[model samples]
Target: MTFDPTLFLPDDLLERIRERAPIHDRENTFPEQDLAELRAAGYLSILVPTERGGAGLSLEQAAILQQRLATASPATALAINMHLVWTGVAKVFSDRGVPGLEFVQDGAVAGDVFAFGISEAGNDLVLFGSDTEATPQGDGAYSFTGTKIFTSLAPVWTKLGLHGLDTTSPDGPKLVFAFIDRTDAVTTSDDWDTLGMRATQSRTTRIDGAVAAAEHVVRRIDPGPGADPIIFGIFSVFELLLASVYTGVARRALDLAVQTAQKRTSKKTGLAYSQDPDIRWRIADMSLAYEALPPQIAALARDVDEQADHGALWFTLLSGTKHRAVTMAKHVVDQAVLTAGGGAYFSSNELSRLYRDVLAGMFHPSDPESAHSAAASALLGPLQG
Candidate 1:
C-alpha cells in the first residue's frame, strides 16, 4: 500500500539473500532462487507505473532499495540491476512524457527479464558507439549481429535491451537502440568465470541475427554522445544504481569490520580490538569514506525524479558520483579488511569476498579515467586537441 523500500525489501528476505550469497559465489552460479523471490515480491516491477500494475517507485526509492538488497548479496543486486536499468530507463522516458518504452514497463510487470546488452569487448565508447551491426530489413525491422560481452542475466533474460550501429540504413550511421526478444539467433556462452561477482553469471552473448520488430525499436540517435533522452536516462539510472550497489558493499564490509573488532580480544591490550586506537581509527576511516554516498545518490535520484535538469552537467555529476562511490567503497573495504586482521585474508572469510567484490567497482562504466575526464570537462573544459 505504501512506497516504503524496507517494506518491499524486508530484513527477512535480505537475510535469505545473505545466507545464500556465499553458496552462489562459491558455486559460480546465478542466484535463481534470489531471482524467484524478488520476482514474487514484485521487485522487478518497482519502476513500472502503478497504472501498469507495478509498485511505481521513484528512482530514489529504487536506489535505496537496491542498496539494501546489495547489503545482502552484491552479486544478486548487480545481476538484477541490468533488468532494473531497462525499467528505470522506461520510467524516465514515461516521466518526461516521451512515451515509447511503455512495453518495457508492461513487460516487466508480465515477469519478463530484460538484460542489458551494450558492453562490447574493448569498446570504451559505452552507450555512444557500437561495433554490433544492425542490418535494416527495409520494413522497420533490424537484425543485429555481433558479440556482446558482459551480458548480465545471460541465463534467464526474456528480452535484451541493446544498441548497435546501423551504417547501411537510410538514416546512415545511426545507433539503433532497441529491445529484442530472446530467440534461436541469440546464444549465451558460459564464459562468466571471473575474479569475483561470480554469482552474476554475466556471460558473453553471440548474436547472429537477433531481430527487433518495428514496434520495439526505441531510439535512433547519431553516433557519439548527445542530449538524447534515451542516452541521458540510461546513463543516469545505470550510474546511480551502480553506485548504490557498491555503497552497500562498503556498508556491509564496514559492519563486518566492526563486528570483528568488537568480538576479537587483543593479547596486548587485554580488551576487544574495538578499543585499540589503530583499529578504531581504521574503522573510523572506513566510516568517514563510506558515509557520504547514500545522501548523494538519494539527492541525484531525487533530481532525476523531479525532472530537475542540469543540462550538460548531468553526465559529469552522474559519472563523478559513480566514480566516487566505487573508489570510496573500495577504500572502505580495504580499511575494513585491515581492521579485520589475518582472518579476513583467508579466502573463506566474508571480508575476503567483499574485498574481491569491491575490486570489480573499478571496471564498471564511468571508470576512474572516464569519470575524471567527464568531471574535468565539466569544470575546466574538454582537453585541447
Candidate 2:
C-alpha cells in the first residue's frame, strides 16, 4: 500500500512549475499553466473515490503529494489547497456516512475547482460564526450576501464552499454551510496585491444574492463550535494540507541551504562554506528542525484517514502541527537566505520569493494565537473564565 510520494510529482513537470512560479509572482497573476497541468494530471480529484473516477488517494498520500508540489511552488500548492479542502471534507463525510456533500465528490470527478470561503474580515470565530447573511428560501435553499476575504483560487474556482449566518430560520440563528456555483451575482475583486503568495490570486469575493440550491445546502448547525462533523472535516483536512505545504517549503529551504553551503567558497580560507564550522552548524540546525515535520504530518494524516480519535485533542494536534511547520519553514528559509548570501536579497531570487511565501502561513487559520490557545486548552483545560 505504501507508494513513493515522488512518483506523483515528476521532476520534469515540477521543473516547469518551478520555472513559472517566479514569473507568476512577479506578474501578480494566478498560475494558470500550473493549474492546467495539475488538472490534466488528475491532481484536482486526488481525494475523490476510485468509483468516482479519481486516483482515490488517502489523505496521507495527498499530504505527501502536496508537500512535494510545494517544494516546487508554494503558491500553487496553497491555492490548490482550497479545492482539496472541499474534496477532503467530502471524503470525510462519505467515510463517516454523512450525507449532503455528494456534490463535492461529483464535481471534483468532473474537474471542478472548489474554493474555501470560510474566512471573513474581523470575524475570528472561524467555523462558529459568519458575517455573511444567509436568508432562508423556505425550500431548503438559501441566498447568501456578504464578502469573503482571502478567497484563494478566486480566478478559476467553479464552486465556492462557504458558510453564512441564517437569522431568519425558525430554529434561530444557525451557521449555514453550502456550495455556490460561480454566477453573475458573484464577483471577484482584483485586490490581491500582497508581498507573498502573490501567485495565488486570492482576491476578495463579493456575493450578492448568490444562492445555494436546496440540494447544495449542506449543513445548518448552531452558530458556535461544537462536535460537528463538518467543522471537524474542515479543520482536520485544512490544517493537515496547509501544514504539508509549509513542510515542503521547509524541506526545499533546507536543501537549498545545503546546496548553497556546498557551492559557495570562502575567499579568505579558499574552502567551501560547507567546510566552515558555522555554516555546517547552521545547516545542521535547519535540518534538525526540518526533519521532524514530515513524519508528524504523515502520522496525523494517516490517523485522520483511519478515523483514529484523538478526542478533544484533535484541534491541538492539527493546529500545533501547522504552527510548527510554518515556524520551522520560516526558520529554515531564513538560514537558507543567509547561506545564499547577497544575491538572495534580490527580488528575483527563489529564496526571496520563498521568504515571502512562508510569511503568509502565519496568517492562515489556526493562527499562532489560535494554535497556542488550542494547545493550552488541551494541556491544562480551558482557561478559567
Candidate 3:
C-alpha cells in the first residue's frame, strides 16, 4: 500500500500549524493544541508496527513526514521528534528481533507520549556515558536520581526514556537505559524560555528517585560507546529526524525568499526583484544549498531502514549528514533574510522567526565540532594515546 503523508497531515492541518507558529513563538508556550491534533492523527505512533495499530511507517517515511511538519511549524515538529525517536527505537528493536521494547510500541499505539531524557548539562560524552545515577532495587527494577536538561515535551510526556550510570552493579559500571512514568520523584522546572523553538518548552527535569519498574528497564551496557542496538537506535533516529526538521526550515525559507523576490518590485529597474541578476543569484544560491540535504537525509534514512552495514563508518555518516543539514539550513535562511530585505527584520516576519529557530540546530546532538572530530577519526584513526 502506498503511504501518503497528506493522508495523516492534510494541507489544512499544516496551514493551521503554520498560522499558530508565530503566536506560539511570541507567547513562549507549549503547543498543546498542536499536540492534541497530531495525537488525533496518530502521528505519535507512525513508527510503530501495523499489527500494533499504528501507521507502521518506516524510519525513512517518518523522516519525510518530519520535514513536512517542520516546514509548517518547527517547534511542533521538534517537540514531536522526541516522541518519534522513542518509537523509532522500538522499531529498531523489532526489526532486529530484540525483545523488551514491545511495550514501547504498545504504549505509542495506546496514546502514550514518550520524551527523550538522555541529555545532561556538561555531559560531553552523550550516548556514551551519563551523569545521572541508576541504582538497582535488588529486583529487576532500578531507581533513577539526577537532573536531565533539555527534556523536550516536558509539559506533557507520559513516559521518559533516559539513561543513568549504575555503579554498584557487579559489572563495575554500566549505563542503564530505562523508562519512568511521571511521579512525585519527577519535578519539571518551568524554565524553558529560549531564543527560538520556544513552543517546545523543553524544560529541565529533576528525577529524584524515580523508579523504572522491572519490566521497563531495557538495557544495561558498559558505558563509552559500543555496538549496542539501543545506542545505535537512539543516535540514528535522533540525528536523522533532527536533520529533517532543519531541512524543512530551509525549504520554507527558500520558498519565502522566492515569493518575496517575485512580489517586491525594484525601484531602480522598474521591475520585480526576481528579474534582477543579483537577487536571482541569491535565490539560486539558497536553492543549491537546500537541494543537497533532502536526498542525503533520504539515503541515510533508507540505510538505517535496510540495516545496511556501514560498520564503523555509521557514526561518521550519520553525524556528517546532520551537520550538513543544519549548516545548509542556516545558510539558506541567511540568504532568505537577505532576499526578503528590511521587512524580514520584523518579529512578525516568518523569515525572522526561521532565522531564530534554525540557530537551535547548532545545539542539537552531533554539533559541527563533534561531527568534524568523528569524521577526522574515521579518516585518520584515533589520536595516539
Model 2 segments more than 4 A misplaced: none
Scored by CA lDDT, what does every candidate get? 0.93, 0.93, 0.95
- Backbone clash pairs in model 3 (N, Cα, C under 3 Å; residues 3+ apart or in different chains), count: 0
Candidate closer to the true structure by TM-score (higher is better), 1 or 3: 3
Question: What tens-digit string does per-residue lDDT give for candidate 2 at 100-208?
Answer: 7888888888888999999999999989999999999978899999999999999999999999999987887999999999999999999999999999999999999
- TM per model? 0.98, 0.99, 0.99
- Kindly list the per-residue Cα lDDT of model 3 for residues 1-385, writing each as its tens digit: 7668898889999999999999999999899999999999999899999999999899999999999999999999999999999999999999989998999999998999999999999999999999999999999999999999999999999999999999998885999999999999999999998999999999999999999999999999999989999999999999999999999999999999999999999888899999999999999999998999999999999999999999999999999999999999999999999999999999989999999999999999998899999999999999998
Residue 258 in model 1: lDDT: 90
Which candidate number has the best lDDT?
3
What's the lDDT of the predicted structure labeled candidate 1? Answer: 0.93
Candidate 1 worst ten-residue window by lDDT: 1-10
Ranking by TM-score: 3, 2, 1
